[model samples]
Target: MSAQETVALVLAQAPVPPQDPGGQGEDFGKSSPLGLVLLIVFAIAVVFLIRSMTKHLKKLPVVFDEEKANAAAPAHVKRAEAEAAKRAEDSEATETPEPEETSSKPSQAKTD
Candidate 1:
């Protein structure tokens, strides 16, 4: 082959990039810009979702603590009863008159 033709053949035969000795290029595909963008978008969406869920949880009202309520309920009832008794006693004392002392004068006449 002429020198010019030999040089052309060599240039054409050269691989775009030298292949690994193990020839693993076929198994590993190149990552694309679109794929990277999609990954980033997915990551951001997950973060936002987590943040929104946390905020929503914070907004939710907690359930009443039944055990604590049960423990405190007796004390509250007792206090209410005491207050009612005190009010009743106060009202009774204010509105009622003292009993009149009724004693028959010693019988002037002595019993036979």
Candidate 2:
């Protein structure tokens, strides 16, 4: 009639679950060959990925700082850079003529 008695009566009539004979079943703690094959495949993929990453990293510049890299360059390389810069400046100067030159060319063409 009471809540405790009703619960006890229901629990007493409930079917009991079967217990295992020992700690483990027949196939417990066993692994299939497919699992081993998959593990090996993943390991090989990781190795290849690491090798590719290392190769890409090796292709990058040793020093990211341009100033330090330039300062560490050889004397001949520095001289070559200076000469190239001078040549570029000279080419720019020659490419850009005074406005007077353009005016004189048009006037000479009109006279001719």
Candidate closest to the true structure, highest lDDT: 2
Residue 82 lDDT (model 1): 88
> What C-alpha lDDT values do all the predictions have?
0.84, 0.88
User: Which residue segments of model 1 deviate by more than 4 Å?
Assistant: 1-27, 64-112
lDDT of 1 at 65: 82
TM-scores for every predicted model: 0.32, 0.44
In terms of TM-score, how similar is model 1 to the real structure?
Answer: 0.32
Q: Which pairs of residues have clashing backbones in candidate 1?
A: none
Report the lDDT tens digits of candidate 2 across residue range 13-92: 96766587455778888999999999999999999999999999997788699998898899999999999999999999
Residue pairs in clash, model 2: none
- TM-score computed on alpha carbons, candidate 2: 0.44
Clashes of 2: 0
lDDT (C-alpha) at residue 26 in model 1: 67
lDDT of 2 at 57: 100
Instruction: Please list the Cα RMSD from the true structure of every candidate, rounded to 1 decimal place.
Output: 30.7, 15.6
Q: What digit string (tens of lDDT, one per residue) describes model 1 on residues 1-112?
A: 9999999999889577665856666657778899999999999999999999999999655877877666657887878878999999999889968798688876477788
